[model samples]
Target: MTRRPNPFNQQAMEEVLRDLGCPESLIPSTISNYRLFVPLLFTELGEERVYQLVSRTRDELTLGEQEEAWRSSIKYIVAWAETVMEQYKHKRSNAPKSDSPDDKQPRLL
Candidate 1:
């Protein structure tokens, strides 16, 4: 793997979100809380799941650090987002399956 940067670059994160088709409304907060939940999301699910989970971006530190307030705020959002992602995964994985047996289904020519 390439050597990674600090994992918290402003412009790079914005560009990445743009590539992912994230909407403008979510661009700020989601990115701020991004690092908090990214690794956990990846490990529990996968890259695609990670993308789906982090649909927004935010800079929790919009004001000064002022203490640990911003960091904790980010953590809270990430935790909530993680629950949503997990629920979505469960729904997807348990979705209705095809009726035909695997090998018995006819393929298109």
Candidate 2:
């Protein structure tokens, strides 16, 4: 089987956090959280389901007013998660599918 690209790599996580307007100071911890949480989410819920969940959470966060200061941080995290899921979906779609062994029959002598 072909190896899939890891979406939770440090560089990708940093980029997503930055793009989501995460505070520079918070980037490290956010990435660390992603490293720990995202894999578990995928393992338990599967990628597509996790993507859907994160997307919904992001939208809800976006719509709700940030009455508490912590809500802003939560928004950033949810947005980052949604973006990472989107990138994963894009990469998954573009990745080449492995061919079946039967599709590569040996040539006759």
Best by lDDT: 2
lDDT of 1 at 94: 100
lDDT of 2: 0.63
Q: Estimate, for each residue in 1-109, the C-alpha lDDT of model 2 and write its tens digit.
A: 5464677477877887799998888887666666657744555565445555655676655544333544455455556766777777789699778797875635423
Candidate 2 at 50: error in angstroms? 14
- Candidate 2's displacement at residue 94, Å, is 0.5
Report the C-alpha displacement of residue 101, candidate 2, in angstroms. Answer: 6.2
Mark the 10 consecutive residues where model 2 has the least summed lDDT.
63-72
Per-candidate clash tally: 11, 0
Q: After superposition, how far is residue 49 of candidate 2 from its true place, in Å?
A: 16
Stretches off by above 4 angstroms in model 2 are 1-67, 100-109
After aligning candidate 2 to the native by TM-score, how far in Å is the CA of 16 from where it should be?
27
